[model samples]
Target: MWVRGVEWLAAAAADPRACTGDWDHGKGIALLEAGRLWDVLSVPDRLGLLTLDLLWRPGMSVPGPTLIDTAAGRVGFFLPPDPSAGWKGADLRYATKGAWVAVPPPYRPARFLEWLVPPDGTGTLHSPGALAGALRQADGALAVLAPLCGR
Candidate 1:
């Protein structure tokens, strides 16, 4: 079943021009053309999870707003509006490379770990306490999915 899915994805990547819809445009289509859909999905998850862990550790301060480059212009994403939001205060901004965006003070860090793992002993993707274990499981799942995705 997985092999078949990979074959289908490969075929889709081979001719992304056929993709037309709100969800398929610009870089998204280009990624398909490059046969990078799997990587596109997985790499960000890995990076986001790692970044979350880094942010969650003790003594870690909130990161400034992030700029994600786009053809239009620079947009800023901030981690937190204030310290009270805990780890849920992050915001994402889009923008072009080399643009400088102002980061407000008391920014919140990402809660990827919390989301992926979970706290409260009751686990949900939105919780943080289970991050380490969730990450381990995610790694295993990714390993299995990688081959199926042709990664």
Candidate 2:
């Protein structure tokens, strides 16, 4: 059952119906604009995985939908429109107005891009504060482990 929210999001594409059509034909990715419905923060997969772990830890709030581009070795986290600054860096890419993201079907995984956490249909998104904190922690963890790993 396709959620109504996902249906509405698909409509934002240039050819709204293309998402479904491509899915049926086995090419399931649609380019959608960012900053309208939400903004996305693209981070390295290692950091993303660690941040996700923190976000899902006991007592922490559940995060919003996230996408992983295995081919690019990056992860995308969906956040509310026009999120505050300080989350940008070489590894942290923010997609805002005029930027387009190759979004996979919300219901399931796609080829190059797959959902790490699928949207729940409601307009829920990651809390910037929580995400930022978790990201910082993840960064620190990596920094400490890098020496031991000889990377």
Candidate 3:
């Protein structure tokens, strides 16, 4: 995959919710894959592309540059905004049971609730059991897709 420049790649590469872009407002990102061009909408849309390359897609990763500039300014694994920034890096060793999953950088308190109760929803949040159950499902999916993980 190839992108235009730092700003474009940052919006396309940063974890969907972590970059804090108002994707709902209809921002467009241009990208190229397999020599074809695409105008992707929203960070989540770009995330899906990156997910194939970085997460579940099968193929040995060719060495490439890792840093990307973001709307929050330039950032990398070492400058975690908080403790939960662990997922912002390239390793899954922090995940429990070695059951790898893509834990996006904003998976902590602030954005965690957004994933649960939408901004306009009732003030309630999902219970701990709900969170754990979801993780279990994800880990199970990862196990089934391990061959595609290129581990």
Candidate that scores best on lDDT: 2
Better of 2 and 3 by TM-score: 2
lDDT of 3 by residue, 1-151 (tens): 1212223323333354433343322222211121011111112222322332342225643212222223322211111012232232222222222122221222222221111111111212222233234334544566577689774
Give the runs in model 3 whose Cα sits over 4 Å from its true position.
1-117
Residue 137 local lDDT, model 2: 93
- TM-scores, all candidates, are 0.22, 0.89, 0.25
Cα error of candidate 3 at position 38, Å: 38
Give lDDT: candidate 2, residue 59. 71
Flag regions of model 1 displaced more than 4 Å.
Answer: 1-43, 46-129
**What ordering of candidates by TM-score runs from best to worst?**
2, 3, 1
Candidate 1 vs candidate 3: which has greater lDDT? 1
Give the TM-score (vs. native) of candidate 3: 0.25
Candidates ranked, most accurate by lDDT first:
2, 1, 3
For residues 1-151, what per-residue lDDT tens digits would candidate 2 score against the true structure?
A: 3466467567667676776677556577778898888889999999999998889877755678899999999989998878455676567899988889888788877788988787777777899888999999999999999999999
- Clash count in backbone of candidate 2: 0
